[model samples]
Target: METTSPHYRHTKIIATLGPATQTRERLTALTLAGVDLFRLNMAHGSVQWVAEIVALIREISAEVEREVAVMIDVKGPEIRTGDLPEPVVLTPGDQIHLFTTNATAPAPTDVLSVSVNYPDLPSDVAVGSTILVDSGLMRLKVLNKDATSVRCQVMTAGTLGSRRHINLPGVEVNLPSLTEKDEADLIAGIDAGIDFVALSFVRKADDIFALRKFLDDRGSPARIIAKIEEQSGVRNMDEIIRAADAIMVARGDLGIEIDYHCLPLVQTQLVQACQDQGKPVIIATHLLESMIQSPIPTRAEISDVSNAVREQADAVMLSGETTTGAYPLESVEVLKNIIQSIEPSVSSDLNSRIKLIEPKEKMLRSTARLAQDLGDSGIVVFTRSGFLAYVLGALRPRGVPIFAFTDNESIFRQLLLPWGVEPFLIDFSADPEETIQDAFERLKEKGWCVPGSWLVVITNALANDKVIDTTQIRQVE
Candidate 1:
């Protein structure tokens, strides 16, 4: 479609832009090496930084003539420790006080204590609750509490630095999904025309609905990606998945909230659920942890990526590996290489794994199976909203290339994230048959339609259905 070639591998790559890959040269290299989306983590950057980076990415997209999607990941209602002069080191049985007040620092005490940003932290956490800091790098158990402070015993000791995250397992912290800071970020991101917004620490569908309402109010078309990293999020996975445009299995904080052994199962379930719904799912966090320093990834890291591919995850993401890593370019290259190597085996059989849950899915699956059965045939799908394109892409039929035609630019960009669907930005015509004929002419011009090469033409206009209406198999003249 559009003369530009599709990636050899169907699975997309999302790279985080940070200190390492923030420059134009590094980002250009990553874009050329097949990074489909760039995630700007709001937890770290200021508004000025985000605006500048978004401008640079848009400039790069214009130069490359590719629609590079930008995602601004907002920091939701999450708690973090305040600034400390030095890292606090504690051993077993050491008492640490977590104060919930403006006075972040205690008066130079030998005993360890730090102030948290949330004033209601002590009220929410019980004496027996467990507190994890910096994704379980340091562990503490609540031993006592008062009106403004919660004193804890250091169960697992590590260096506790300034502005570290705080996690209370089995404790429900009543906070609004969107904080004031998140609203500011979202407004700025929408003004900058970000393609996606990832909401962090999402606990239920309501969180996603609130963000959606905000976006709709501003008439912004930026899609919402729910970051699932909490136990409540895991429990409400179905509602969250249905509510959000996409999902990211954020394992960094998830490992701290849930048992370590359960992370894999949760990841698998999330990926499978997203696949079943035809929504994109990203496997993120510590995928190539070692590559942050070393030039190469560990064997387990390779297998981890490979496993996501085998599971038919729509995409895999690089967090720290492409952010502050010394080997950012190497990490992207290695991830690309691994996907290229393992794609052929898994992509061809991806349709079999998808359960046909809905009528649209059933029709789409049958269309894909037909195209695969008829060797040397190509598929041309005309979608107005891009829903049908995503459905077919999720099915992942063998050997058949899908040529998707849509007029909407947002749909064109969203189509890039899905697998097997090569999207083209074309004008919409009132006559469905005329549009089909025009699309075929373009395909024939590109030699995609050759002698004895049958083609399957699919569209949603023939039936009364709103999502997807029709699939017709035809032989090329």
Candidate 2:
């Protein structure tokens, strides 16, 4: 399979892990198919299950001799209907009482009432408010309320399943950023040595700050990826982009919570915002959704993916398409094909979009320009923390491959999430010139370059007994 050929894919791919794709063979197949990261959605499995899957993924990565990162997406501050003894069918104008489990249940078990996971629903919602159950499949209008319960008339009818997600459109409910279960799952993921933690429903910068503090308290080196799926998150986008290490335009609930028509604009805006700040942003949810059933994706879905690639998002994610879909491998192949086809057509003048404020930022912008000037050039960097490589990836140096070398295995895995970065793990030498020559030899050995290939090597090496950044060009030998 040639490992899906990373040459044409500047935009990375992230796939969710599920029962359909949980086996070691399936994981290996997806990794070789160009999956840069595997998302562990905490919404589906238990903590123990997540730890075991992480171990399996690590094993698969070692066997394949490739770097694949694992991200644990925390189920944060979700509102859902409680379990039902039987499926409840509702029609227009049918009324039901909704209460928290802490509140007293109605006398009869057959009553047309349900318990919500959030206790604040009664106080948070008001009369004439529209509440969407199960991603707006059924609509409920709050007609009346009391201390512990809110009486609602079902405006739209559907079968209400247990633990169905509840959405209060145009109403903001107060909930802690990290639910009890979220904290537990995060702890397990951190202990399992996950590369990234994606916090869901990030409404404000404080949400990211709190999660960062949580990870910091435990000395977890994992970075935070803020999910912008709520209007509040969009409203507070500037701060959230600054607070979180990376951002994800989670279009699922954002489409339900806000006007679906505006989702495209919001996605581009979020991606641009994250890029302007040099943060890697992911455009997630339904990139190739039709492939879930059919092997071929719809034209509309392909266009959606092209838009994300054209916008230069760090990655496009697969949810059900790779998790529970019938065509997991095809989904990845389709995405990779779409990305490679469109990326070549799009202009790589994104260097103008970014404001080079920091000295290193300005330097990397010049690096990209210089690479363009050199023609047939590649940027080689050595970083223990992967910071220089991340910034260079953000610069979107089209046609110039950035080969990042790191001694830290964790950083090697973490670097896979960034665009345009191909991470290589190698042991560094005590001598600076020796290490640079070693990088050159590795580039040649891996067929990244030939004898006459020009390489741009960037590193912070000891010079005159003090470490300083250096950039120089060398021909592969």
Candidate 3:
């Protein structure tokens, strides 16, 4: 069961590492503050940095004796402006001809233009097309095109910094899901034994399939988390959800790529879609973003966090707030506090939301209901492959915290993302009864249960060389 001691919160928290949490001391502090996992954003750090930080986190996790998972977010197929010696200022009606990286500047017209990182930009867009720079802050309307350039008139005024993100709404991106740099970063992450991989700006299920195939060939057991940020991704949500091991609502680009007014509706739809498919979905980007500077979060931010919690997201993530923020620890606590405050007010049934297609899942749902019937009972599951634990978590049983005991270290770390699952790594004996007792001993040592605390245990018993499924309610001595 999830007690306040080892692990308990229903909504998990993920924090990014940066200058603020680079050292071992700060990393340990954040872990103790209730960060279940750490995200390494490949966009900002180098491959060498990824190896070093994963080692550092492992060292800290060993010292703290907690299973904290690590995830790598690959910068997948992003469109950004080319490096500029200085910021380019664009005002309304300003004409700029964006040229390919190797193309020569069009015959020195009164037009101001900058080189684009993607050479295909000239071919992908057409006249009257709109291109957004710097997260939609600056808008450009295509006026004309050539083999080497696309001349455009500015629709919105803004400054464009070097490598600023570019978004083409309603346009399909013709880029590989995993860039060369992304592959290199993924290799580093795989070597470092990361538990999860997040593919940024995932446009379709094939993107997930491509990354999955790459990982499978390398024998990497890391699960894939597809980040839906573009319009194409929204249109192909069902297939993406089916292909991905998990989903992330990447609101930063999503808000810009789609109608801002309908972003909330889209968010709700994404969350529901994940729930319906029994996949873990994360709500990310700009959550408590202001807390990066101020210790206090705006009320609106609190409400936003509250809404995600109410929607029953598997996890909530902090981007700049943890990596570059002044108040990293406070940011973690704020998210934890909000999750704690909101969970009690909302109730949802996983059985109704997700179809129980598997027999194990249906039985697991029944076990959850049984635990609720027995007051003050917690569900205990001893899983070898972590399948039982994951299925039970996807069932979204309320009031009963799932104490998943796995002998496999990798499974223990991988289970950190599911809702209400507190995974523990312990050795399993040949005798199933001894294994059950060992799990009980752990619960007693942690003070999670008293002399008479009830536990609903699900395990397979080895009898006559045959494994027999068993579900029983036992009282602690």
Candidate 4:
């Protein structure tokens, strides 16, 4: 398989592997089509199946003489109602009573008995609070609250099935972010040498730290990615961004939390913030929604993908389009086309738009600019959360490519979408000097640089530390 493409030089595409495209041949075709990384959604399949796919991807990459990253997406905390006999449809203005007590529907009413795992569900919910089911397929407004049940009125009419997802906005649905299932999956991913682990529904920085500590305790350190979907995530955005290895703009659940009309603004703000902080941002969900069935994409979908590329998103992803869609191969091809077509139009003058601060910020930007001005072969950024790398990329410094070396595997894989950023995963080291030397030698071995060539290394002096204390411009020898 030929992995090189003129159009893919600046941007990377991530294709998900699922039941629709799990064959070795299909995977090979996707790789040939210029997929820089493969996302293994652990939320959908068994561990054995995912392990097979990961092995196949690595085998194919080795055979093709190309490097491809694999990212494992963990199933985060998700709340849902238990089984229903059939799809239940509700109409606007209909009174739907959601109860903890057993009840059946019949009397000109849309009341349904919903099973909630949380014992204090009724107490946590307040009147007038919104309840979104199955990503807003059905909407319910709280009418009255009690100790065990909450009466509600249907706000939207739609069919809902068994185990349909439930979303409570502005209400703290107390649940562990990482479930036992996710912990098992994380262990499997780490054992498989997976490049990334994406944490879903992250609400605070503590969640990230806790996961990191867990990995550390297990002696398996995978990069932790915080998927921003809830209003709490957006409110704690700055701290969350600072804590995780990378950030994912998960628009599906986000739409359920905030108004759909506000998604575009949220997307832009999140992307800009990630860039400003130098952390890789992934624009996920419904990038090619129409392509799930059609062989090609709608004009709006094309524009959406183009906008992500123009925004300099590290990578653009297709969830169902490449996983369980009818046109998996066609979806990958169409995404490749859109990415290739829109990449050249990306402005290389993004550095001027970056807002520079003082002390560390000024020093980091100065080093990045110097590298670009001196025509250094590449700029090496050692980041825990990928913030430094994103900042350098946002600067849009020309001539010098940005190589992000991190211990976090999720950050390594999530970086596949950013313009000019090549993420590499390495063993966590305690010495910055050894880390810098290793990076320089690795780049030289890859012919990315030569002896006597200029290279800029920017990293926090302390290993596993967030504070940036050093920036060095060195002549490779």
Candidate 5:
């Protein structure tokens, strides 16, 4: 499949960088194969490693002449089991002890025991609470607990490994939203000039607010992407979406927190909520896990990516599939192929899923309708903040491309997160008319618009030093 040109597909691809795809050659291949953004996971990398990856991404981005975004995924307050001597096999009827510790304790031979990094796990969890480990591959039911220890009975049997993630569904663990490690990483990421920072294990709007405050205090403009991976986050998704600049459907921990069968419904709801609010939503984790080992993806994985596109998710992410996969380039190609195949149908059937949340949305909707009615014209959006472009993309105007021109580079990268919105960075012009004319000329030169073609142009008209939403129909000369 021809995967080099992804301009036909508006849904972006976010690929993780790790051992397999860390080299310049492999990263370049991923960029050419339609990876719009690269994610660096702080969970497994050091500050120096992240800096190197950021540098590599910029180098490749310059080489490709595409402003590929870089997102630093901070490991937030996550509960993880302490080290284990070896993988312990648990049976359905076995009892285990979980305690809190800072350092790796001696191997426990007396009982099947483990420790968590969170010291309040025993105090937070109660009897009858469920404990999931290793992304819910192993499960345990809490039978007893104290300040020092939590006794659990094995409900699901599996081999438990060391330093695996621990989840307590329905139990609120008293841990700070930002760990000390995360703060250090955040500083490093800001210094590296990352475009976005994804806060892992986000459970409330306050989490986003706190991170926003941190960024604001430092005068850093990196956008925050709230990762919804907990039950509390799902329940309070409305406020979280309002607070976050973007969202990531972190289905790995989310599947562990909620019923596995309900994931599909939850994903759809999250995607819809984001679209309604004009926030970019990314569906992540296990999109193509089979590609990690094999050269080709399974049929089911292909459908999973397609469904996310149909749901109008701004992007579908590849975690381990591209990070540690042997066929990282092939994974990117396969994902692009799937999106390119499904996006046409999605665009043809696109409808107004966005609720008129604000008064500006109503006008945006009307403008989109006008573009659709004209049928032969595309939409040109001139913005300094990219807000108008985001609103139009959320409206999902079928059969019309939104060419957004912005003076801000950050906004241009952020614009790529929306569906059907292609952002171009141009010099800022004080006169709105001049900006529109320049944009029209550039669009014509790029073959997106032609002479004598009609276009619906949207911008904030300047008059009396006040800006207002203005949509004008013009014929390109």
Candidate 6:
């Protein structure tokens, strides 16, 4: 197949690298199969293995003469049960006691015993809150709560082994999103020059800012991806979206947090929000669940992928399918074919389905539309807030390259997957005109525009610092 096959256009594929597809040969095959990015899940493998795979991916990208982004996923603070003798199966209506202490034997009477690391977990959880174990494989309801323990009735019983994750829905478990292990992994990823670092379980914008600072301190400038898994993250989605480079709809844990039936709606809302902001959003997890073992995807799975494409997600990720699948190559091919089949059906109109409340008051939108109308060779947005770039992105002008110049390196690096948006970090200009001139000169130097090409510049006007107020169309001379 041709390397620049239409099958891969406009759709970014993130394949998880694992024992099955860790070799140089398999990595090369995946890249040729249209994998645009490689995911090194730090939760599963050692730092040495991850480092080896990262090196292999770079080698493959060099051989192909294409830039393939590498993402290192940090395993955030996950609360889990202690060691169990074997898989413990519970039937419906079974009573279970989760305690803080590590007790080897089963509970004295009607209670099944399990241990939690946090001693005050029971006090933190209130009655009526749901306890999800093993990534929502089992569900329990808190019937009573005390200072150190909570009594729960099993809602959905399943076999669970040692270290299965525990989630308390609607209850904030006081824990840091980035654990000690994650901090070490982040350093390793930065040292390896990973393109993106996915921060798992991001609850607020502060989490993103902290991670960005961490990267700066390490002198490893990588794009920070905020994984939206909790309800808090979703509620504060706009702030988080503004703070990070991109957002990932981590559906696995998200499904555990919200009703499964509500997932589709949540996914749609998140995609639209990201689109409106001009931020790239990824629909992740279970896109091709059956492909782990089988060569083909289920009809429902195909439809799911098609729906995500239709929703205009910049990327769709496969976790286990590419990581530990029996048919990793076939899975990639199937994903490629599905995206190719769906691309033509995707709407190209920038504002076709956009529902902008108070559209007249949105100066960024006005500037973006004016930029599109000016018929410039390219559009340049000078923004410290990243709002202007996102506004221009929402316009979706055909064939016009959008360059985002910002002093914030994090904002610039995050624009990697957004359609037509190129992020560059420039020294902050003293004035707006200077900023525009500097942008123009930089474009010329980079060969994005010639001396005679028209370029549109958008930025904040004096009247409203909160909104974009200036749209200047100038021909470079």
State each model's CA lDDT, in order.
0.82, 0.86, 0.87, 0.76, 0.84, 0.77
lDDT, candidate 2, residue 175? 92
Provide the global lDDT of candidate 3 against the true structure.
0.87
Candidate 6: misplaced stretches above 4 Å? 1-8, 102-110, 351-394, 397-416, 420-477
Which candidate comes out best when scored by TM-score?
3
> What does the lDDT read for residue 183 in candidate 2?
92
Q: With candidate 3 superimposed using the best TM-score fit, by how many Å does residue 423's alpha carbon deviate from the native?
A: 0.0
lDDT of 3 by residue, 385-471 (tens): 777887787777766788999988888998999888888899999888898899999988877787788899998876798987778
Question: What clash pairs does model 1 have?
Answer: none
Which candidate number maximizes lDDT? 3
255 Cα displacement, candidate 3 (Å): 1.0
- The CA root-mean-square deviation of candidate 5, after full C-alpha superposition on the true structure, stands at 3.2
For model 4, the superposed segments whose C-alpha errors exceed 4 Å read 1-8, 100-111, 350-391, 398-400, 403-418, 423-477
Per-model root-mean-square deviation over C-alphas: 3.6, 2.7, 1.9, 5.8, 3.2, 6.3
Better of 2 and 5 by TM-score: 2
lDDT of 6 by residue, 1-477 (tens): 111112224556788888889888898888877677788898996777667777878788779845467889999888888898888888789888888774344454667777888766877787887888998989888888666566788999698789889887766667876888999888778777787899999988989988998999988768788999988888899999889888999999999898889999999999888876667788999999999999899999999999987786878898999888998999888887887787667654564444455643265556555555655456677777665666566555544567889887555645545654666778976687787788778777766777777777766556645644666778887
- Residues 299-362 of candidate 1 have per-residue lDDT tens digits of 9999999998888777889999999999998998888899877876664554555567778768
Task: Choose 1 or 3, whichever is better by TM-score.
Answer: 3
Q: Report the lDDT tens digits of candidate 2 across residue range 348-440.
A: 675466667778767787877777678778888888999888999999987778899999988998899888898888899888788888888
Each prediction's TM-score versus the true structure: 0.90, 0.95, 0.96, 0.80, 0.92, 0.78
Sorted on lDDT, best first, the list reads 3, 2, 5, 1, 6, 4
Model 3 alpha-carbon drift over 4 Å, by segment? 1-7, 102-107, 462-465
